[model samples]
Target: MYVAVKGGEKAISQAHKLLAKRRRGDTGLAELSVAQIREQLPLAVDRVMTEGSIHDPELAALAIKQAAGDLVEAIFLLRAYRTTLSRFYVSEAIDTGGMRVERRISATFKDLPGGQVLGSTFDYTHRLLDFRLLAEGDAETSSPTARDSEPEPEPEEEAGPMGRVLQMLEREGLLVPEQDDDQLPADITEVARSYPCDRSARLQSLVRGDEGFLLALAYSTQRGYGRNHPFAGEIRVGEVSLTLIPEELGFPVEIGTLQVTECEMINGFTRLPDGEVKFTRGYGLAFGQSERKSMAMALVDRALQADDYDEERSSPAQQEEFVLSHCDNVEASGFVSHLKLPHYVDFQSELELLRRLQSETDVAQPVEEQA
Candidate 1:
């Protein structure tokens, strides 16, 4: 057990200095800029932004840089920074149907209205390291590949927003749709904790939850834990305009364009009171191009809705308290990281108890031998 000590202000300060030095290793090498991280490590920045519950890429990159690329630390930094900002008007629910889609695909359909758009993805690429990238990383040591070596492909035809896959099912009355209420949606960030949280609150929590945690839970559902005959309805990644209507202006105004990934899962159908069966939807949305996170979120969403569908809720994914309470990386990190702090007193107490038990055992053994 480590012994607790006091009077180390100078030592603490020196340790911080040492930490900074280590974070900036090898003085001879060029330092990385926040811009470089924001542009090059875009997926990392996107993850930070999504789980951080903040949409600013520049700030996320800055936090990543300051935290020495520790993403959980970066997420924590972003959340703390968000507390200082003033509350503005809440934007209206984004109309993703009209998204300027860059990538659109449907697993259920071989060919949809928009056609399968294979945008920038690593899905087809072999898991092999290009030595050229290893040799000339950001330095660009080699000459550029000649355009003349390969035939130029024909450009894609101009098209407006692609059609939604769910619309097809909805048209046939095969999929039940979410009822839209006129009331303002719940502000999950400001709302106080309460039992039996609304669907809005649950969704808000899930979106901000850790990607890895959600992925694991989603995988568990597929492995028969919370089995829902799930089919990926659609997955889309694109930029959408954020719009808000002010009380005074009485008209909607475009606020900002945000990159987002959305996934929809068509789960096993349930027979209603009218004796008609309709497929259920598990919706997932994430900031930036986070297809995996969105898909996982969708699966977990369906699992969590087991009660609503009159299905047994015995799975870990279906347990709202377990999933919501522990999915946050920032919270999980804080709980685990606290172990690094001085726990000498607690350990000493444990050691004392162990010693007492051992002494009692020793005394009992001697008496029993005498008997």
Candidate 2:
């Protein structure tokens, strides 16, 4: 025990030093710039921002570097830093209808007014690694293709203000009308409480929840646990403007725009008390090009709503307490890592008890007579 404790202390110290050295790489090599990470590794920054519940890309990039690229650690660092800031004002809820869309798609209807715009995506890319990337200065820069001598045909008709597909179903009495909530949303950061919370509070917790945990829970649902057959009614990726009302100004003003990913999931219908069948919906939104996270979140959100439909809640995904309690990577990391702390006192007591029990057992046993 003494050796283990001493060795662990030494090892931890050396490991930290080694990590710092590795993170910096060679003294002759140029240090990695935070700007590079923010620009080139945008998805990593997105994950940090989503889980950290913070909106600053620069800060997220720094956290990623400080944490040596461990996304969960970066998220924890960013979240911790967020608590130190002062709240100047709360922004008005964003209006997605006005989003300047870069990408939008619907699985429910391909022939929707706005034909699917497949933006920058890896969906059709072959998974082969380009060896040319290993060679420096191989990046090609080319100008946009020249327009034909003939005047460009009139641009495809812009889809009149893209409306939600689910809204159409609701209009036809095919889906339940959305519940109106006048109560202020519960802020999980301030409340720091357990489950049995409202949908607003639950969704607040879920947006910042661990992506892997949410993904696994969502996958379980697809495999028949808390199955809520879901169709991606719409997944939109774009920039949405934020507006904050300043007390001094006495009017709302645009702060800035934020890149975000939002998903609306349509689920199987259930019969109401009035014997009317209506479709259900789950919604998810997150920072920057986070399609998978949003989709997974939508699935889990619908799964956790099983109680509202009077469905069996036997699945882990459907149990609000179980899912919310274990989904924070920060909490899980601390609890799991705490086992490495010194437990000498506890071990000593157990060791003494074992010795006493063995002594008593030896005394109570008879010596072998014939041997």
Candidate 3:
């Protein structure tokens, strides 16, 4: 058994070497740099950072290259790296209201403050495949001229504070007022797992949860399952500065800025005691310019708000445990991937049991025939 275990360890080490070699691919081709992925494929890096619950773009980019562009695997790598780091300071709450607005839009209003700055988007893009991109890739490798061929961007006008649309409704006394609690928000990473989690914990979970899973849940809500009449109150993408107060300083100090996407989905499913109907909100905040994930998170957030409003919990989205438990892709992937591990002993035992049962059945049949 000892010898067999030693051999297995050697095999695993060799397998890792093969994997590393395969990850490198054809050596003649230029090796993809972490900088290229961080700058060029930024959205992928953003997704990795967001899902991984880590905020380092360079680290995320390195993880992406190491994982061979597998974003989920990259997320796994980032999470694993996170486990090694010591928690220094929990940064002060991010102030999205003071964001350096890059993209801001509202579906409920035709026009509003900051006037729909569509900074960078694929919303108006034609779905047709552009073979030019393939040619461009080839040109980038073969020709240096192709690198700076794209036209330079124009100078932008000085922008004002991009105000929240929800504020406008709030001024009209039409929006539901939020609890003015000064309670420090709990960190999900620090806390022990509990069922039917609080708002802060739930938000943290949804923020870092699987994007595709949340998107599907959001789609289901829109398609009438746990449907809440949602209007995109606001969807904003931009950079927000982070501040942390060290124990020594006792004052807030600027740490760094992170690109974030925030979505506020207004739902009219609840009424007030004053006999005047008001719009309740579902909010989502994620790292980088992740509009879809934030929006989906908002929808799922609203659906999960069913308990607060005494709404029927008939849909999968409304069931907090069901969504929260299964949403962590890392946990889900680990369980699913464990199938690749050896189940030799279990299989052998099952095989022997099956044969013994078959033999007993054969003996019973022969005895019955003789009788």
- Give candidate 3's error at residue 93 in angstroms: 1.4
Best by the TM-score measure: 1
Stretches > 4 Å off in candidate 1: 1-6, 137-160, 367-371
RMSD of each: 3.7, 3.8, 5.0
Comparing 1 with 3 on TM-score, the higher-scoring candidate is 1
Q: For residues 1-371, what per-residue lDDT tens digits would candidate 2 score against the true structure?
A: 32245557788899999999988889897888999999978999999999999999999999999988999999999989998998889899887767888888899986665566666667778989877777976865454343624644433545567777777888999987776677798888888756577888779888999999999999999999989989999989999999999999999999899999999999999998899998888888999999899999999999988878889998999999898888988898978877777878888989999999988877777464223
The digit string of per-residue lDDT tens for model 1 on 52-72 reads 999999999999998999898
Off by over 4 Å in 3: 1-6, 137-160, 273-275, 357-371
Query: Model 1 residue 203 lDDT?
Result: 87
Give the clashing residue pairs of candidate 2, or none: none
Write down the TM-score of every candidate: 0.90, 0.89, 0.88
Candidate 3 lDDT over 27-100, as tens digits, reads 99888999999999989998999999999999999999999898999999999999999998888878899999
Q: What RMSD does model 2 have? A: 3.8
User: After aligning candidate 2 to the native by TM-score, how far in Å is the CA of 242 from where it should be?
Assistant: 0.7
TM-score of 3: 0.88
C-alpha lDDT (0 to 100) for residue 278 of candidate 3? 81
